[model samples]
Target: MKIEDWFQTLRSKAETIEEKWSDATEQERLQLADQLFYLRQVSDTVVDLWLQFEERLSIAIRRIKQMEGQLPVDDKHTQVAVTNETSDKDSSQSEVASAPLKKGKESTSELKEANPYDPVFRRGEGFYHLRMFQDAKKCFEELMQHAPDWESGRLYYAYSLLFCEEQEHAFREFRLLSRSASSPTVVASSFNAIGCILAEEQQWLEAAQAFKSSLEIKTDQEEARYNLALCYLKDGDAQEALDEIEKCLQKDEDDWESQMLWLRAAQLLQSMDESAELAPPSPIQLPTRDLDTDTLQEMASLYESVGNYHRAQICYHFLTERLPREGWAWHGLAWNTWLIAGTKRALTLMKKAISLAPDQDDFTFSYGWMQLFDGKIDEAVRAFRQMLEKNRENRLGQSGMISAYEKMGEYAAAKRMAKEFTEDQEPYVRSLGYFHLGRLAVVEENWRMAEQYFQRTLPHISQLREVPIYMQLCASKLGEQTSVKELLQPEL
Candidate 1:
């Protein structure tokens, strides 16, 4: 049977088992659970086998193309080899005529081998390891023309380019690799390379952004943190610089660059403090006192906006302690905690926020969304319905209801709620409408309509987890290949 048909039959059997197990004896339920576990393992094994088959097929196709001379050759490398051969044969006319013949032989010999374990690649990598960057660059430049999708070879080529002081070429190569590479380490390293290029050009803000992107992908990159701190110092944001440097020091206390940068930032802050003490207070300055809950709340919002979730969590934590009745403080704390902790803790905080502000549509809607994220679909539906009763125009509540219904397999109800929000002016709300409609189309096996709806939603909600996967599935059903690797890229 086809994979899709087999999946449909398996799903029907699973549903039947679930229905029977719900009313079964304890022993029967235990047997059903064991069967379900075995089915899950079988499903995982099938997916792994499919992925392996796809990889082997891709390799076979590439080899066939290379054998047929369909792959592009490196003309620069070929021309240089030809020119040298012509120079050696200039003394004899007969030899010169045969030079063209010799050139063809040389060209064919110089062509990169189809094997991944080709000796030339190892030689190039050996040269790179020995710090012979120019030689390595030459080898990689030729290798890339033959195997452009070889990620490790491409990354080494970019690194060689950077070491050779070809910053522009290196930056472009790293940027391209970051977009195409699936490994988080490779993507983070690429961003780090781009950051180094920007830093060398004295583009502090851009460099900071690049370093932040790198650290977001792989937070253990101490080098990226040190570079980010240096960029912040260069931009005169001493506090932020100090904070980043302190984080680096925590990871590696003996890191010389981080240690020096921390001292410099500390001195700058101290000097600013001394200068403030010597100068008269500004007319607009507020009276000196302990920070109030309102001040802490504002600071938390600012920190959260800048992706400083740890600091935001601290501020919100203090606010919650100082003003226990403040629902907004609890709400903000939940969001900040959600970034640092997981959904369960965030759900607990959100519940407190909703209880403190029962009339607040935002709190109630957020609670419902949290419930949806935690897989409490029935509870989420009830919360969303309650929110909708309180405020009929709540876009988030409407979207939540549609999502809950869709998750529960209530396609008709999901479609009805989706239609109600389809004309909403908000971009996210309208996007949710198209998203649920696409999901319904998928259930109905209408691949073309699903593709159309997903395309409409992509511009507004491309970041949704299910969007890229479903889009790729639809494309596959239509006999087109589409990469969905970017959807799995890690973020802060």
Candidate 2:
């Protein structure tokens, strides 16, 4: 459909959805939310396509306001471009006619002008946007054959190669472009792309050099700096990593990834056991106390997610100084301290958090888990039971209770809870169930049963790093000569 028609259709559909939402049941409301999520994805994809459709018509899509959306078409933009091209052609033609033209150069220009690659290029781009990488690669491959000097076509071809898992070919092509591309922007991007590929292969030294080349070309290359810092960290230059990430934070202090990297670098520099393992950073606090509340909260949460509990505790400490009465700040601080320091000191903090926010289930759940972690079986079981009494559907409470049961040597109760968890809707929960079952089997010296349980877990959530470690332990018990050579992880 035309742009206007599409816009109107979207607006009408949005308004109808909004009108239905107020009166819809819970299930229907959830269905509507899914619909909106998919629609937003479609909108984002279309926006990306439009940004690449033409050089001048980039602002065709903009942010929504209230319930309305706008997509302005600049008709005059195309007209002006065509007019300027024609004027330039006429001027060039006159100059050529007046002067003694070099026939070879003229013929070369004519050959370029006559090349039938525009449609092929556009088709390749369409396939690229639709995520049909093989088809895009074929089209771009044809373009490369016919127009070998076309850098844009080569760039697209490289991207398609990467998308198609032909990373070696993509790396070679990008490296070529990085050294020989006419456009500064393309050259910088090529270097960055090369760095990413090398970084994935764990060639940190080469990757860092590539990123440095990208930075030399474009001084404001933030992504290159981020990549370079990661490379530096991996290459055993924690000080350089810290310095590079500091530059990123200087430009954008709210960059949570930069803060995480900064925290990581500091941790590495201070750690005695600086191997491949990701340990929490040292100094226990940030150098500056000038970060805003939201930035600090996000940094803390990010650190928590990545298991840098020490860094999270540091953020929470700063937060308590600013928002002492906030229960969540205390709760966050309490958990991280328990994780990094000890449960003894964290117990008082957990109590304070509970007192301030008695209604928060997370605080209750953590309090229970902390007790369980500290080997206070009776207290942990009671706390978990209390939480479940208030809300039986509490997944955390159920999980904690199961662990408590296992600790208390109540195999029957633990097995029952784990069986229920196996029937849970979420696959991750099912994996957890199997994991607990496997743990129980290990405890009972049922090696074969434990192996089967962990094998079942692999299909559900293979990415959980602990699953393999447990499996390896089980294997060793069964007298199978196996070793964990490497733990493969998705890189940043």
The per-model lDDT (C-alpha) reads: 0.68, 0.72
Best by TM-score: 2
lDDT of 1 by residue, 1-492 (tens): 897899898898789888998689999999999889988998767755654565466457546765777654433221112111222322101111111111100111123334553445655655665456798799889888988866667877887887777878988899998899866766777787787677767788998899999899989766677778877777778789877877876775544335445545554453333221111112212212255555565556545544457767888888888889989989989988887886888988988998898888888878777778778877888889998887787777877877787788888988987887678877877778888899889988999999998877765542354687798899899998866654333244
Which pairs of residues collide in model 2? 267-281
Q: For candidate 2, lDDT tens digit of each residue in 160-240?
A: 887687989998999898888776656776787787777777788988898899889988767778778888887879889
Range of the 10 consecutive residues with the lowest summed lDDT in candidate 1: 97-106
State, as a TM-score between 0 and 1, how close model 1 is to the true structure.
0.37
Model 1: runs farther than 4 Å from truth? 1-312, 336-344, 373-375, 443-446, 461-466, 476-479, 484-492
Off by over 4 Å in 2: 1-224, 227-257, 261-275, 279-287, 305-307, 459-465, 485-492
Clash total of candidate 1: 0
Candidate 1's displacement at residue 276, Å, is: 40
